[model samples]
Target: MGLSALFRRKPHERAGFELYGKAVAAARDPWFFGPLGVPDSLDGRFDLVGLHVALLIRRLRKDPDRRGAALAQAVFDAMFADMDINLREMGVSDLSVGKRVRAMWEAFHGRAQAYEAAIEAGDAAALAAALQRNVWRAEGDATPEARLLAGQAMRVAAALAEQPFAALLRGEARFPVPEVPADAA
Candidate 1:
């Protein structure tokens, strides 16, 4: 996909070319399109996050050498700890915020383990196929994480740079996190 397409903002999350009111500070940077995104505005940004997180989770699962693992962990660190603390300034409840963080952590660990296992077994085709399914640039347009996992794999850990206020509360995470991919043992 073209760079413009990859960087295209979600309409529901944006008020025209601008972001969804800048309700979220993290939404303003490239990282928001990172792992799950440092979500600033809660508009379509919420949807972008799930796709990104799922892709990240899948990538981690296939990493036998733990590539980009620390950064993934760090994304959670900021959300569950740092970012969560910061958003408290905005009047969001701690419990609600905590649930969101926990859900994201679950998705990340679950998908990561599954995808990493696939790669370790020399299943490039399977890995690619799995990634293709997660690609946001497809039929309906991509979300934050999907765009991130599209091609390159580095610059991923810091991808989240920070998690938004509601990464796990929507989309794929809302759907039901598979402990392992259906075809896996």
Candidate 2:
């Protein structure tokens, strides 16, 4: 279904889907990704950026007009993610580039720099092992708190749909920005 339907919150009713609505809600809120798209649960700056950017992209699609600081931040975050991915891809070693590439397949997967270093050092076996391990998966099911936050973010995103474009692309800051906000604290 189109985002129009996605953003169009239905009547108060329990959904058949397990917290899908909550997920949608979480993606909308500006604060969902933490300060300046910093990954609350992972390593690296771009990771957070990509997360927020992805959410912003969804929100923008639903309502292009409501592109604000959050959307702008998201775009910037996405761009950074792309750059990091490209850099990480490039720095991969010939011996294990393929292995590392496969291991790094997950979108929101977390990992230590050692893995990247292994890829850079050309350890195909390590990279392959890492990929096969799939270490990021949690043992139990997703927490109720997570689902609630996601739903809230989705609702926030839906509400933020009517923003303006200029806000997202304001100033000269585009790619490789030095600072996102003057004082986010």
Candidate 3:
């Protein structure tokens, strides 16, 4: 590769940034903060964004080809890049930014594993438990809000599954509108 190529983003990397943007937008949906009562603080926002990014990564990693792996890494890179920028903008000193980003990366991976496992098992209760612990910062039995969010996660997974891998590779993602569970409503 030429020296110029080193500075320029590959096409897949560009698509990763685009996909990350879409996930952030989805994370910002008002339903989560309003009805679901996710905290509006930085930590809350980070968890929400992490959730969306993790879901996308789960889908991408399902591809049997190297393209899937590359796109997943790109998306992961874009997420940490955004996190680093946000930390700096929040006035975290340059020295501590790396430490903070490392912590955030670890936190994201832990939650991603929990969510992925629960979703794969089709175990709503487990998913709700994980969401309660991560998003609501709660313990013991899952709360109503956590259950609702868990339901939303399952819906999102199914929706994402129906979307073509080609579409996601092209930098587009579709998330279902968050729904209130029937019993909750």
In terms of TM-score, which candidate is strongest? Answer: 3
lDDT by residue (tens digit), candidate 3, 1-185: 89998898765988899999989999999989987899999989999999989998998898776698899889999999999998999999999999999999999999999999999999999999999999988899998888888888888888887888889899999988887666666
What C-alpha lDDT does candidate 3 achieve relative to the native structure? 0.91
In TM-score terms, candidate 2 sits at 0.34
Structure candidate 3, residue pairs in collision: none
lDDT of each: 0.39, 0.38, 0.91
In the range 47-118, model 1's lDDT, one tens digit per residue, is 334334434444333344443344334333433454366457777787788776666557545555544554
Q: Which stretches of candidate 2 lie over 4 Å from their true place?
A: 1-48, 63-136, 139-141, 169-185
Score candidate 1 by lDDT. 0.39
Assess the local accuracy of residue 127 in candidate 3 as a C-alpha lDDT between 0 and 100: 95
